[model samples]
Target: MSGIYIHIPFCKQACHYCDFHFSTSMAKKDAMIAALKQELVLRKDEFKGDTIATIYFGGGTPSVLTTTEINDLIATVYSNYKVIENPEITLEANPDDLSQGKILELSQSSINRLSIGVQSFFEEDLKMMNRAHSAKEAEQSIGEATKYFDNISIDLIYGIPGMSDARWRQNIQKALSFGIPHISSYALTVEPKTALATFIKKGLIKPLDDELAQIHFQTLYDVLTKAGFDCYEVSNFGKPEFYSKNNTAYWLGEKYMGIGPSAHSYDGKNRSWNIANNPKYLKAIGEGELPNTSELLSLTDKYNEYVMTGLRTIWGVSLDRIRSGFGEKYYVYITRQMEKYLEQELLVVTYGHLIATKKGKFLVDGIASDLFMINLG
Candidate 1:
């Protein structure tokens, strides 16, 4: 089954560490929504033979849009595409935007799931990250949202400069108190030209501590696992029957069409991305053109991507798949590279799949890169 990812590019305010494609100004929200609907209509035939099983509303903040605006977008999808019955629809939201009235309205809408951006339940961490919501709002939003949606996921950040182990533990405990079914947490990274990077460069804020982040990750894995959560993917934990279908589909290499500025698409061969600039995107779409660049994937590119994504999840690299799909050369190369990691107890071939061991979970990216084929014809 295929999926659709709609990127809402408007945000009420910018987070200090974010480098995502988004504009703080909502002056063009109407135009942007129209363009999004138009894009969906334009790309309806892209996934002709496949039924869309998931629809994800991700962005600067999907909650920023009114319920009517979201419903219209969904209506366009239903009108244009072959959406499956009861598709898993998700909207990424910010706590500040999830007021009780808004939550109630959304609960009545077609959106079945919500992914809240609650970075922390502590005021200092919230301020440090420049999140728009206060700690009280973070707790309150979740408290209210839970009454409406059962399939809820929240995002939390670790490795903030002054976040302590005790504080991190408290954050996890607080989330558990809400009985949230899924959690996606990540270590804070300072991207170039982001406020976090500039602050560090100017000595205004302390630099991120990688070692500390690693420690925090390990602690998180331990805590969640003990709470009966599955570390199904790196940085994602889910209780039984609550895994994110949209994310799982993407990781398993399902084809999806992304609409709106800075959105991306894959059709099993070529990958494309929309223009990141809002005005440029709108003008092009209005002129009956898609403002995007495309690339057809080569065999080498596909193989490397498979290796990268496969190693990060519980579903490890399949030796049988490698041999059948990529040829014996790639299979043999992978087995050869496995010798070193297997020796170090970092990876193990369990049931013909190369799974990362506990020792290698935090270092999966580096390990996958080491196993990548630099030159394959």
Candidate 2:
């Protein structure tokens, strides 16, 4: 089965380290929504073979949209795609927008899962990130939301300046204490052109220490693993039965269509992304054209991507699948390269699956790079 990803590109306030395509202005929201609906219809035949099993509303903050707008988008998806009976519908929201009333209203929609962005439950951290919500709101909102939706997920950022390792640990314990089933924790990366980068460059704010971030990540893995939360992906942990189906679909090489400005669409063979500007996207779609560039994946590109995405999750690259897709020689080269990591205790082979070890998960990208074939084609 495939999935649907809806990108809502507006935020209440800009975070220091955010690099995702979004705007703080709402002037184009209505027209953008209409354009997104048009884009959905225009791309219905992108993936014709599989039925949609997951519907994701990801964004600058999907919660910022009115309930009517969200439902209309879902209605459009239903009009074009053959969605499964109980598709996992997810909306990525921020703490400030999720009130008890809003949570209750969300329950009335097709959405069944909520991924709340709770970067930190501390006022100072919130201020540092220029987040619109307060620390108290972050803690209280999730507690209130759990009463309405049990299939909840939270996003936490670690390794921020002034957020101690102890504080990060407390954050995880707090999430578990609140009975949140799925958690997506991440390291603070100061992307270029973001506020954090400027501040660090000017010495206005101290930069994040890589070593400390690594320590925090190790602490996270240990605590979550002992708490019965499985590390299904490098940056995500979930209870035994709480794996994110939408994200799982992406990892498993399933095709999905993304709608809205800066959204991406991937069929099994081709990948495309819309322009990052809302006005540009809306204008193009209004003219009955999809505002995205497309490129067909070369065989080498596909193998490299499989190695990158697959190695980050529990399912490592399959040599057999490689042999089948890329031929016997490619598999032979990969097996020879994997031996070095296996000897270094970075990868473990069992059940015919080459899975990344706990130690390897941290360096998964680097390891995958080493295993990449020059010309799988």
Candidate 3:
């Protein structure tokens, strides 16, 4: 089954460390919604024979849209695409936008899962990240949301500028206190053009310590696993059935269509992304033109992508599939590259599958890059 992702490019404010595409203005909100519906209708033929298993509302905080608006978007998807019975419809929301009343309204709507952005429950961390919610609001929103929704996930950031190991542990424990079924955590990274990078360049904030981040990742894994959550993906922990269907479909290389500005779509062999500019995207859709660029993946590109995504999950890269799908040459190259990591116990071969050890999980991305097939024309 495939999925549909709708991107909402409006946020109340910008986060210091985020470089995602979003506008702080709501002047064109109505027009943008119309464009999104039109885009879905325009692309319906792309998934003519596929059944949609997940409809994900992702973005600059999808909660910024009213429940009516969200339902309208979902309705558009239903009318245009073939959706499965009881599909997983996820809304990425922020604490500030999820008041008690809002939570109740959303629970009554067609949305079944919520991915709340509660970066941290500390006042200092919230202020540092310029999150729109306070510590109290973060806890309060989660508390209220749980009363109405069982499939919920919260985001947490580790290795923040001043976050100590003890504080990181507390953050995990606090999340556990809420009886949440899923948690998506990541180490803070300084994107080149974001305020976090600027602060470090000017000595206003200390540079990120990779070693500290590694330690924090281990702590996260240990705590969550002990609490009965599976580290199904590198940064995602869930209780068996609560894993994110939308993200899992993408990671597994299933076909998906992304609607709205700055969204991305993948159709197994080709990938495409819409324009990141809000005004330009709106104008193009208004003119009945798709403002996106696409590329057909080379054999090397497909193999490399499989390696990159496969290593980050509990499902490791398959040796037999690699040989049969790509060819024997790729299998040989990857097996040769796997020697050093295998010797170091960073990567292990289990039942013919190449999997990362716990020691290597935090470093999987770098390891995956090292194994990339390059210049194999």
Candidate 4:
């Protein structure tokens, strides 16, 4: 099964720590939406024979658009693409946009899952991040949303500069109390060129401590797992049936089509990304052209990608698959490289899968990097 990702590259306001491509103005919303639909119809044959299992609306904030606008896009996909009978259509929304009226409208739409951006349930944290919604809105949105939608996920952030452990725990507890099936929590990273980075540089905000972040990660894993949620990915915790289908397909290396500005697409051998500029994208699409660039993947690039994605999920890298699919040379190299991690008990070989140990889960990215084929020449 394949998936489709539609990027909505507009937000009401820029968050302090965000680096994703987006515009704060809605002046080009109509033109951008038209361009997005055109892109979908243009690339419909890319996954001609495959059935679409997931359609994800990700971005600056999909909820900013009206339900009618969203439905038009969904109808376009349905008319042009081969979709499954019951596909998981998810829309990423912010708490403030998910009012009772909005939730009611969305419930009647094609969207089956709600991925709400409830960064934190604390007003101070919301202020620090410059999120559009307040803490009360965060709580109320979920409360109102659950009445209509059962399959829902909320985003949470940890490791804010002055956020204490107790406050973090309360955040988790507050989320859990809602009986929601999925939670995607991430550390507050200060990306380059972001307002958070500038603040840190000027001492306007305290620098983030790695040790504190690590502690928060552990706390998150412990709290969620104890409540019967599976920590399927590093920052994702969900009940077995509630895991994100779109993201899981991506982690498993399944093919997907990404539409709209700054979106990406992969089809096993080649990867491409659309232009990040909104006006440029609209102009190109209006000219009946694709504003994107692509490159074919080398064997070394594919191997590293598998290693990176495999270790992050419950499905660990298969040594046998590496040996057979990538040739025995890669298998031998991996065997040798993994010896150090195995000796340190950071990784374990169970059922021929290179799964991370509990002690290594928090540092899996570093471990994966160490095992990368750097001298791929």
lDDT (Cα atoms) of all candidates against the true structure: 0.93, 0.89, 0.95, 0.93
- Candidate 2: lDDT over CA atoms? 0.89
In Å, residue 80's CA in model 1 sits off its true spot by: 0.3
lDDT of 3 by residue, 1-377 (tens): 99999999999999999998999999999999999999999999999999999999999889999999999999999998899999999999999999889999999999999999999989999998899999999999999999999999999999898789999999999999999999999999999999889989999888899999999999999999999999988999999999999999988899999998999999988999999999999999999999999999999999999999999998999999899999989999999999999999999999988999999999999999999999774
Candidate 4, residues 1-377: lDDT per residue as tens digits? 99999999999999999999899999999998999999998898888898999999999899999999999999999999889999999999999999899999999999999999998999999999999999999999999999999999999999899988999999999999999999999988989999999999999999998888888889999999999999888889999899999999999999999999999999989999999999999999999999999999998899999999999888889999999988878899999999999999989999999998777888899999988887663
Structure candidate 1, residue pairs in collision: none
lDDT tens per residue, model 2, 1-377 = 99999999999889999999999998888887888888889988875667999999998889999888999999999999888899999999998998888888998888899999998877888889899898889888899988889799999888888778899888889888898889999999999999999999999889889888888888999999999999999999999889999998898899888888888888989999989988888878989998888999988889888988888998878878888987777778889999999999999887777889988888787899998878546
Q: Candidate 4: worst 10 consecutive residues by lDDT?
A: 368-377
Q: Over the stretch 1-377, how does candidate 1's per-residue lDDT look in tens digits?
A: 99999999988888999999999999999999999999998888898878999999999888899999999999999999898889999999999999999999999999999999998999988998888999999999999999999999999999889888888999999999999999999999999999889989999999999888988998899999899999988889999888999999878899999999999999999999999999999999999898999999988888888998898888989989999999999999999988999999999999999998877888899999998988895
Report the lDDT of model 1 for residue 78: 93
- lDDT of candidate model 3 versus the reference: 0.95
Write down the TM-score of every candidate: 0.99, 0.97, 0.99, 0.99
Error of 3 at 182 (Å): 0.4
Candidate 4 achieves a global lDDT of: 0.93
After superposing candidate 1, which stretches have Cα over 4 Å from the reference?
Answer: none
Which candidate tops lDDT? Answer: 3
